[model samples]
Target: MTGNTHIVGGIAASLAYAQFTNHDPIIMLAAGVVGALLPDICHTGSKIGRKLPLLAKLVNKLFGHRTFTHSLLFLVMMAAILNAFMPFEAVTAGILVGMVSHYLLDMATKNGIKLLFPIKLTVRLPITTKTGSKVETIVFSALTLLSFYFGYEAFRFYL
Candidate 1:
């Protein structure tokens, strides 16, 4: 998926996590957004990638696209890593939800991610569409709308 789609998915995931856990909505939202972008650090062209090009290039050289970073193993590892520092259940939940959202969004694209990695199985939805295609645009728009609605509700309830 494109950056916009990833961003929308991140925001939506964070909002949902906040609503579900009754944690600090702002912190969850921020963590979720960051977590969503974390996996794409391997791609030199991604927003986060550009910020740390050397690290991104190193990751790409070692793992390549849709390999280690896009796998369930990676998600689990990340959750564990975050859990150590965050300790808080709500923060860990937000991170996991954000990562899952990123994986799911990539699955919806034509070139599905290597979810299982070493297993070499690419899990994708039945509906096949290119990233940033018309279908993706529509999906992104819907996600954006949902994100906005959730944000408004969160603000009304919390602030």
Candidate 2:
């Protein structure tokens, strides 16, 4: 999946979560975006990678793309690190949800991801598509619509 699709997936997941949780939407939205992009740090060509080239390169060299960074172990490590800096439990939940969303989106791609790393096993959805194919564009559009729907459902309580 492309960065934009992952972003929309993040937003959609975050907003849906906001509907049930009491966390601030703005904060959750921001965290969601960050978390969604964080897994792609191993890819130097990724949106987040472009912004932090040195870190991306280092990670890529250390673990290669889609290996450790996209694994459950990485998620646990991220949760621990995020908890140290972000005292708010909601923020951590939002970010982790977004990261999960990222993994799910990538599973739809042909390349798949190492969701259980260190085991060298690649996981993917039964139906997969090319990264930027028409199917991905459709998925992106659907996620966008879901984002809007979830946003409206979540924020309606405030209005």
Runs with alpha carbons beyond 4 Å of true place in candidate 1: none
Q: 1-159 in candidate 2: lDDT tens per residue?
A: 999999999999988887788888878888898889989999999999999999999999999999898999999999999899989887898899899999999999899999999889999999999999999999999999999898888778778
Q: Residue 73 error for model 2, in Å?
A: 0.4
All candidates' TM-scores? 0.93, 0.96
What is the lDDT, from 0 to 100, of the residue 32 in candidate 1?
82
| Tens digit per residue, CA lDDT, model 1, 19-115 | 7667887877887887788889989999789999999999999999877888999998987788788767767777778888988888888788889
Query: Alpha-carbon error at 133 in model 1, in Å?
Result: 0.8
lDDT (C-alpha) at residue 35 in model 2 = 85
- RMSD, one per candidate, in order: 1.4, 1.0
Residue 56 lDDT, candidate 2, scale 0-100: 99
Enumerate residue pairs that collide in model 2: none
The TM-score leader among the candidates is: 2
The reply for model 2, stretches above 4 Å from the true place, is none
Reference-based lDDT, residue 63, model 1: 90
Model 1 worst lDDT window (10 residues): 86-95
